[model samples]
Structures are given as C-alpha cells and as structure tokens.
Target: MSVTPITTANLLARQLKNLINSGSLKDGDRLIERDLASQFSVSRIPMREAIRQLEQEGLVKVYRNRGAVVKTLDASDIDEIYQLRALLEGEAIFQSMNYMDTETMARAELVHRLLGSASEPTQQGLYNREFHELLYRRCKNHRLLEMINGLREQIERYELFQRRLLSDTLKFQDEHEQILIACQHNNPAAARENTVSHILSAGEILKSYLLSR
Candidate 1:
C-alpha cells in the first residue's frame, strides 16, 4: 500500500481540530499564533496555514486585529449545518450506491462493529465517520464529497457534545445497520432514505440538547 504524505500544515490542522472537537479549545477562545507555534514546536508560517484551513472549515474566525477565535455555534447554526448535511450526505450515498463494491461493504461492517465496542465518545465518533466514509467513498462527485467532509468536520464538535448527554450509541448503530442492510440488498433509495432520516434525527436531538443548555 502507498503511504499518503503528511504535510506540516495538515498535521497542525489535525491537532488543532482535535483540540476544538474535544473542547480543550473552547468556543470563542482566541488562538494566539506565537503560543501555538511554541506549543507545537513549529514556526509561525505553518501555524497560520493551519489556522486558515480551520477558518475555511467554519471552526475558527479570524479578525483584522483580534486574530483567530474559535467559532461558537448556536442552535440555529446546529440546525442549518445538519440540514445541509442531511441533503448532501443523502445525495452522496445515493450516488455511491451504484459504485460501492463488496470490499467497501465489508469495511463498513467492520467499522460499525468497532463503533459498537468503542467506549469513548471521541473514538465512537471517529469510527462513525469511517463507516460513513466507506459507504460514500464511491461517490463520483469529488466536490460533493469534499463539501460533505467539510461539513462533517464542522459539526464534529457538536457531535461530541451530544455524545456526552446521549448514551444511545446502540440506536445510532441500529440506524447504521439499516443503511448497511439497504446497501447489502442493492436498494439505493432505501439507503438514501435511511441516511437522511439518521442525520435529521441526530440534528433534532442535538438541537434540543443545545437549546436546553
């Protein structure tokens, strides 16, 4: 297997994204460039590039003089993002149905099993992402996949929040199973419907939790 090259900027970006998703970097917290560079042992250049990438992903907002602050999400932000996710992910899964092979289906099943065994919400979330990515990897539209990934990253923090309160990983697993079953049966329309329902249900649950906070 060929190894994918990892860049300094991408590495820094992943670390920063982890901080945000884990809530170590709180919402609206200012990111000091020099401090982060020192912490990560990188120069200002790659740090800035990572910040720019996060900003593009809606995780950070850079100001003229104030520098970068973590973007705070309200209930409305959660609603809008998930709504977009429902639409984009649903369509992507539908398109991928024709292209999905047996190998990908097996991989997805493996990830789903791992998700069931993952005790930590963060680990579960990662496995969940892998499961969906496997299902959607065959999507022919590169741009749509890119957008879906961006949205997924943007909403990961919210997913972490939801997982803290909701212990219904089994329900999510069941939904994932339904989607997989649709794929196994070669039912694209059923797969699309299940995916959209799963996303929208997650959105509603997250929205209610966010509003209650």
Candidate 2:
C-alpha cells in the first residue's frame, strides 16, 4: 500500500481552509504571506503555495496589489449556488434511487443519527455532508457528484452560521427525515422534491441572515 505524504503546503492549505470555513478568517480578509508564515511557523514558500491552493478552490482571490483576499459572496451569489445545488442534487437523488439498497440506507440513517447528536456546528455540518453524499454517491455520475461537492464547498462558510442557529438546524433535520423517508418508500419524486425544497429553504434563510447583518 502506497501512502501519499502530506507536504507542508498541503497541511497549510487544509488549516487555512478550516479557518475560512469556520469563519475565523472572514470574507475579504487579506492573507498576508509573511504574517501567516510566521503565525504557522512555516516558511514563506509553503505559505504562498497554500494560498495558491485556496485560490484554485475559489476561497481566495488574488489581486495585483492587494495580494489574496478571502472570497465574499453576496445574497445573489448565495441564491444562485443553492439553485444550482437543488438542480444537481435533485437529479443525483433521483438517479440514485435506482441504486439505493438496504445497506446504503442503513448507513444514511446512522449518519442522520450522528448529525442529530452532534453538538458543534462543524461536527454537524460534517455529518450533514456525509448523509447527503451517501445518498448521492450511488448516482454513478462522477462528474455530477464532483459539481455538487464543489458547490457545497462554496457555501460551507455560510452554512456554519446556519448550523449555529437551533431553529435552522431543527428545520433541516426535519427535511432530512423527509428525504430519508421518501427514499425508504421508493418515492424518487418525493425525495427529489424534498431535497430541492430543503436546499432552497436553507438558502433563503441564510440569505436573509446575511442581509440583516
């Protein structure tokens, strides 16, 4: 078994991604190579490489004079992302219904249970991803799944805020249950509808929250 080594740049990129997703590094915040290198006890080379990685991931934007700034999305961006998510994930779940079996559903149920029990926003978000991925992975459309995951990554920073709200969490859980039930009953239309509705509802809530702030 060959294990890939984790390079310094890769490690720094993952840490920076966590910081951004957790909102520790807010939108529009500048990523200074010298400052970050000193803060992380790394050399400037790896820090620069790390910022480049994030730039490719759409989390950081590089300007000629301003260096790299954390990417910020407006309400319209949020709405558009969720719209795409609904379309892609709805199709994914609809297609995956043909492949969903007892074992997969059982795993999804377990993930849902874990999500309910998760106390921290980050942990809950992870389980939420797990649950959704388990359902969508069986779609057998690799490119479709890739696009869905990419869009999910784009909105994760905003999702951190939504996860922190108990009301929002409760609503999402209920929707998750609806989706799971639809799957178990072999109702693909209902599953897709529930998934679309869930994404749109969450998008609206997040957009409102951001606008109010």
Candidate 3:
C-alpha cells in the first residue's frame, strides 16, 4: 500500500487496525513492543501513542505489565452503540437530505466501486467509513457529525472482530447498498429505518462473536 499522508498517531492506528482486521493481530492479542516497533519502522514513542489511541477507541487494553491487548468487548458496548446509532443516525440522515443533492449523489454512487475493489479488510473498512461520512456531511450539522463520527469509529472497530463471521459481514455490504439506495431516492425515513436495522443487526452479530471469544 502507498504510504498514506497521515499524522504519526493516525498512521500507527491504521497499521494496528490493519493488523486486527487482517487476522495477523488476532482478537485479544497482546502487543509486543520490539516486534511492532520493528515492523512499523518507527520509534517506540509513536508506537506507544498508537496503542494509547487504540485503547481510547476500545480496541486495546493497556495493562500494567502486559503492555496492550485487544479488548474482548462485552454485550454492553454493543448495546450502547446500537442504541446510540438508532437515536442519532436517523436525525442525522434526515437533516442530511436537505443539504445533499444530485452532485453528491453521483459521487456517492461511484464510492461503492472503490469499496468493492479494496484489496484488504482495513481498506474496505476505511472506505466504508468515508462512504458514510460523505453522506453524513450533507447534514451541515457539525456537532451531530462529530458525535456520529465517534459512534462510527466504535462500530467499525468492533465489527472488525467478526473476521470469520462471514454472514454478518456480507449482511453489512447489503445494508450499505440499501443505505445508498435510500439516499438516492431521497427518502430520509427509509434511510433512517435502514440504518437502525443495520446497527442493531451489527450489535447482535458482535454479541455472538464477543461471547464466543
């Protein structure tokens, strides 16, 4: 992959996120200092910052001696995410429809192709985020977008845990298509309803994987 133009911490997050999504950094895998530092070709300082960022995102747990291990998310986190998404995403989409129009719709239509061609899971995941954010930006509500951004980050990272849960992953792709369709049709209610089902389904899927792990 071409080196992305990103901040040191963001670059670290992307690499570690890639590790998790690719199954190299398996769930609950403890981060080894020397190994990761060597692999990333960076100093320990940036590596530590990345770990701290992951911990903030609920992707890693920073223990006393263990350094950092990926968190085994419990049911409560899933529930909260879905609950929050249902509460917020609907309004965000409704507000967005007024701001997003034909040109943005054309661009959104092409984004799916980019996501489909992504070679790796993390790339696909980031594209997935960019896809939704493009639509979300139409809302023109900064605070709402900020809140939803955090929610999306948590949702995406947790969903990454379902690497072998192919069924749910496929379901998400279908849901993404549905979201795009709703946006194209300019139906906010349909878009909102679809998003709620999508997020709630995600919570259920995540719960099964979390419990099994």
What TM-score would each prediction reach against the true structure?
0.83, 0.85, 0.69
**For candidate 1, lDDT tens digit of each residue in 1-213?**
999898899999999999998789988899999999999999999999999999988999999999999998788988898899999999999999999998999999899888877788777767878889999999999999999988888878777765653356467878898999999998999999999999998888888877887
- Model 2, range 1-213, lDDT digits (tens) per residue? 999999999999999999998789999999999999999998999999999998887789999998999998889988888999999999999999999999999999999988888888778877888899999888989999999988878778888687787334488889999999999999999999999999899889889988998
> Can you list the residue pairs that collide in candidate 3?
none
Alpha-carbon local distance difference test for all models: 0.89, 0.90, 0.75
Q: Backbone collision count in every prediction?
A: 0, 0, 0
TM-score winner among the candidates?
2
lDDT over C-alpha atoms for residue 19 of model 3? 76
Model 1: runs farther than 4 Å from truth?
Answer: 1-8, 117-120, 164-166
Clashes of 2: 0
Q: In model 2, how large is the Cα lDDT of residue 6?
A: 93
Candidate numbers, best lDDT first, in rank order: 2, 1, 3
TM-score of 1: 0.83
True-structure lDDT of candidate 2: 0.90
